[model samples]
Target: MSSSIWSSLPFVAIWSVGYWAVHVPHLLFLSLRNTIKPLRPVPQWSYRLSMGTAVLRAVFRYIGALRYQQPLQLTPGRSGDRFVRIAPPADANLFRGVFGAPSAMAKPAPVSAVWSPAPVVAPSSSHPSDGRRRKVVIYAAGGAFVTGFDPEMSSRFTSALVTSEHFGATNLLFVQYRLATRADPFPGGVLDLFTAYQHVLGLGVAPADIVLIGDSAGGNLVLALLRRRAGLLALGRNNSRSGGQDRALAHQPVRHHGRAGSVLGVDAYRPKGKALTQEEEGYISPMDHPFRLETPLYIEAGGAEGLLESIVTFAGQMADVKGNRVQFHITEDMPHDFFVAYPFIGAKKESCEALKRAKLFLEG
Candidate 1:
């Protein structure tokens, strides 16, 4: 009826629409939370909590009222061996309206007990030879327990030695291990790693001539296996020779190359034996495993990553070992997984340099 009332009608309509846009997702999240009530406790709850937090943050951000900054610091009293739980980024608006309502929680399915063989890319004949066959290098990828191992993130590091300029003559193998959410923690992935290593060794690669490469979590695995080898040696349980019937096979060293190198992708939190409930940290942490051999090691980490503390601790332990040759490379201002971010950040130059350094370390 009145012109003023008519003009005000549009403003009210816009406000109503915007309000629902912000609140509807929150309502759906509440419904999802209810759905998770009957499921067995699994790490999947972590994923749900993360999603919920993201959605809530988005609603606040959309309203121009959310002000939260995730502290980059690690939790106090935690050891460097434990995995860090990072709070989502402060600007959580990125997840708004992106997810659907959580359905009935899926029944906890039995995780496969069988270990699958690690994927091996066939060696190309074009691989140059340095008079003698170059030693093979196996790479394990690092995804802070959740991400990575897809075609893009893994292919580069797995194929680096064979595909890249440095050490292209050398054979390379990429071992894909189970991530945190998919399987029971700790030895689950480690056991898979052992199986893969054994498989590779069975394929005629000499333990003395093989080199292992891993970054971040994969780095942790490399150290874990080495420690297991030492423990086995101490107990005289290094039964690697028992399975081989041939005299030559019986005498082969239990471990390939007798050494391995790891590139530590710094983590934010370090579990000091008691920091977290995760089982992997209990036995596999470099902090808990003493370096027993003169394993030539190359340790590298980005200066800016929060995991530098863990890297430093790992290096210190390795350095204390008698007869160990450990090289530490700390790059300036490179974020976690800088090399893998090459496609998105145009960091190929920096990544190439790091890869070059890594190749040199492995070769030497």
Candidate 2:
């Protein structure tokens, strides 16, 4: 080989190794963390093979490469990330006497990522004032029900939220729920989500001070949670939203879809298994629930995403039912999860505006 070519080969080899080290492990960990069990459990060897393939894909990102377009600029926050296990009240008892209670409590499914804002450099940029209740945002990520949670996406988004002048939130918790698979599908993931919500509440944050945010399937979970809360309150009021019951239950949660099922041959895009009935699917929807909520809800969606139709329908129905309590921001021509791309895409202006509105909603 020529001298020039030989000299340049080392740099190429070093770059390749660096990329492999960072990205391959990420894909592998994700595959393992969100394992798919078809019937009972995925066979050990098959699981390994599946993860190996995923890691390999990460290592070689482009087997059939397409010509690259202009890169989008994303201003991800410098927020610190931490992992913690959240357990139900009963589960907390199991760790009471354990030497490694924290570790033991963390072993269960549905790990969470906590992102703390960067230290304030400017006095004017400090956290919310003492008079104002510090906002605590519990974010759920969107990935059509089948895909598992994305921590990087969640962290990046949270970082943006807390660092930006719009939100200036101090505490952000991103829940990583079990993804839908053959063994753990549909409502199974929803249960884990409920536990996550309970865990947050257990931390003593008032339901009124909490802001629930979700995209795609995560959006589905958020709606489900509010619905459940509304249902509970309604039951206490004799399931009536009229007369004395309405006045008495005014403080209860007022409840408030997305797409990809088309490719899967199922309407809900549920995990690979049996299909769900319209009523069963509707049960998971946030639109069906009716009640009033003290907490404000902020929803962001791209107009171009597959789930736009369902999302628009849900937003419209909820807005009519709950009035100003539900806020919806739709960005034309944008795809799913546009907030994560706030710094780069042409649609970022709308995304940023949506967040600003969300901030205002929270302040009120």
* lDDT: worst 10-residue window of model 2: 243-252
| Best of the candidates, lDDT | 2
Q: Could you tell me every candidate's TM-score relative to the true structure?
A: 0.51, 0.57
Model 2 per-residue lDDT tens digits across residues 156-270: 6556754467666566666666554344445554555567655655554555555666655566666665554554554453222211111000101111232223232122234
lDDT of 1: 0.44
Candidate 1, residues 158-272: lDDT per residue as tens digits? 4553346853535555554544332233444454455555555544555655665666666666666655444445544445531221100000011111112111112211322
Clashing residue pair totals per candidate (backbone < 3 A): 11, 4
- In model 2, the Cα lDDT at residue 344 comes to 34
Task: State model 2's lDDT.
Answer: 0.48
